[model samples]
Target: MNFRLFSQLSSYHADIKRLIKIALPILLAQIAQNSMGLVDTIMAGRVSATDMAAISVGASIWLPLVLFGHGLLLALPPTVSYLNGSGQQHRIAHQIRQGIWIALASCIPLGILIYYSDFALRFMQMEPHMAHIAQDYLHAMLWGLPAYLLLMNFRCLNDGIAKTKPAMVITFLGLMLNIPLNYIFIYGKLGIPAFGAVGCGIATAIVNWSMCLMMIGYSYFNRQERKLQVFSQIIEKPNAATLKKLLQLGLPIAIALCCEVALFAITALLLSPLGANIVASHQIALNTSSLIFMFPMSIGMATTILVGQALGAGAPEKAKKLSYAALLLGLTLTVVTAFITIFYRYQIAAIFVTDEIVIGMAATLLFLAAIYQFSDTVQVVVGGVLRGYKDTKVILYITLFSYWVIGIPLGYVLARTDLLMPSIGAQGFWLAFVVSLTFAAVLLFYRMRKTQSLSDDVLMARLEKLK
Candidate 1:
């Protein structure tokens, strides 16, 4: 018994080291990607709280919608990873090609939704000037939608094959480029008209196009990509059957993600009427938490790759062990981040805006954000491992219930009505986040445990379907 326990511990230790190897690049890449939001908040806030609010509101409208498409494409990585693990590399190029079709098909509808975002703004009942700024911000981002979608497809391709560094390098370059572009567009330098908050969207659009082009170029030149031949038959007609399978896998993931993101987006909108100070404060707290969130999110994403690969290699037991290691690692990292958030809440809030009222409010909210980190990390990481098992529908169902039914309603009652207590405003939403995420974490952990207990014969049946 002692020897067996020691061996298991040794295996877990090795798995964690491997998980971090894959996760670190993904973490840096996500940080670089989300830092653009931080940049937008800081730069836009410099102009005025209203401008910051505009970016916040505009993001609320577009991001969830955009991520809806993004979530759909996320189905690609695990699929590719499974194929790679199972020695079906010959089929990868065709799947990637079909994925590109999904990306292109998605762009038009998502763009159309974002194009008419003024309706959403109006529904939010924001002041007209703030509404106009948000509308303009959405419009500017439309140009980048296609590029962003295509870039995600390639990024997923790379991640599936465990080649995360290329995206890290490219996104870092994009971030480097975005800063200067933000300055030029926001401040109207180099003969460009100053677009204020709207400029963030424009700079991001340009960066998206640039990153997409760079990724395409990289894929063409990448040695592994050449071997995979992902681009060989660029114009192959879309297979209806293949596309259907992708959608069946992808749609649930997309809806699940949207369900969660929309809760935040709607919360932003609900907070809009309270004033720019409150909305900007909410953005600051949310942004800080989001940046910190990259750590666990990366861990989860890496787990999807690792778990899928392990299972593909006909090692269900290894995949189960990998999930356990990932969850432990994620919770450990969350503890560190939560501590950082607690200690530096005020200073972190100050990084975004100078308003004393906003800073104080944001600091309070950051404390609440800290409270949810454990639950948040568990749920997200567990969700990733489940994806590797192709157990997606439970994720969709659980997230929908937790975020929409439990969290949102509870939050609205606390934030907007006197039914629960006096309205706590933005703090109520953050409080609800803790509750919903805890519920999700508990349920997802249960689901993962159930998956881990599947008999070898059952597990083999699951893997057989991947063929």
Candidate 2:
């Protein structure tokens, strides 16, 4: 019995090491991607609290739109993962061509929506000054939409085939450019006119285009990409069946992403009535949490690719073990992160604003955030693994129940004088976040377990038959 236990432990450790090898580049890529937004927030915050609030509101609008597009384009990676696993190198270029077409198709409508976001902000009834700041930021951000979407498709394709290093390098290069670009645009340095938030948008657009071009150039010249034939096949026309398959896989992810984002967006909307101070504080906490979240989020993405490729290779047991290994790693990392947030809550809060009330409120929310990290880590990683299994419909239901059925209502009651508890305001919202994330974690884990039990060969056979 002792020998068996030791052997099992050794096996588990080996699996974890393998998982880390796959997950690290993905984690770094996510960190770089998230750092761009964090830089924008910090730069905007330094300009003024109102500038921070404006960016927050604009982000509340912009992030969901961008994430929605990203979710739809997410289909590319899993498709590429499967094809790569099956050793269909020639088919990859065709899929990439189709992905680009789909990305462009999706980008056009989203660009139009972003272009009209200023008009939409008018309906939100924010204070006039805040509204103007938000409008400026949104308008500037609009130009990056197409470029960003195209880059997302490229990143997804690269990541799907387990070539995450290219995506990471491109993202890191973009982050390097983003800081100086933000400084130039936000502060109007180097004898340029001060653009403030508007400049942020322009810098972001430039970075987006730059990243896309760089990825394209890298893929063209890289020996690995050449060996993989990622650009060798010439697709002369759109494949309707392939496009439909991509949408079928991607749309649920988009809805799932939108549902979670909509929950936070609504939270922002609800907090707005409390005062700019509260809203500003919430944004601070939100932005901080978002930056920290990239760690697990990257792990989740890696989990999807690893599990999906394993499934494609007809290795159900391997997929299951990989998912569990990734979850364990994510949980461990989040626990360490939670400790940091708990101990440094006040210090982190102070970075966002000078206002005492905002600082205090943000500190309180950070404590709640610390408590939910484990749950958030679980939900995100498990959901990613499930996405790899192509089991997203249940996730849509899970998010709906957890976020709206439980989280939002509890928040409403706690935040206002609408229930038994005293008005806890935004802190109340954080409590609801903890509850919702916990519920989501439990449900997603259950779904992942259910998915892992199925035979990968059967699933792939079914998919092939459909094809």
- Quote the positional error of residue 267 for candidate 2 in Å: 0.8
TM-scores vs. true structure, each candidate: 0.92, 0.91
Per-residue alpha-carbon lDDT of candidate 2 for residues 82-131, written as tens digits (9 for 90 to 100): 77766676677777788888778887777787777878888877789988
> What C-alpha lDDT values do all the predictions have?
0.90, 0.83
lDDT of 1 by residue, 99-164 (tens): 899999999889889998888888878899999999999999999999999999999999998889
Clashing pairs in 2: none
Minimum summed lDDT over a 10-residue window in model 2 is located at 458-467
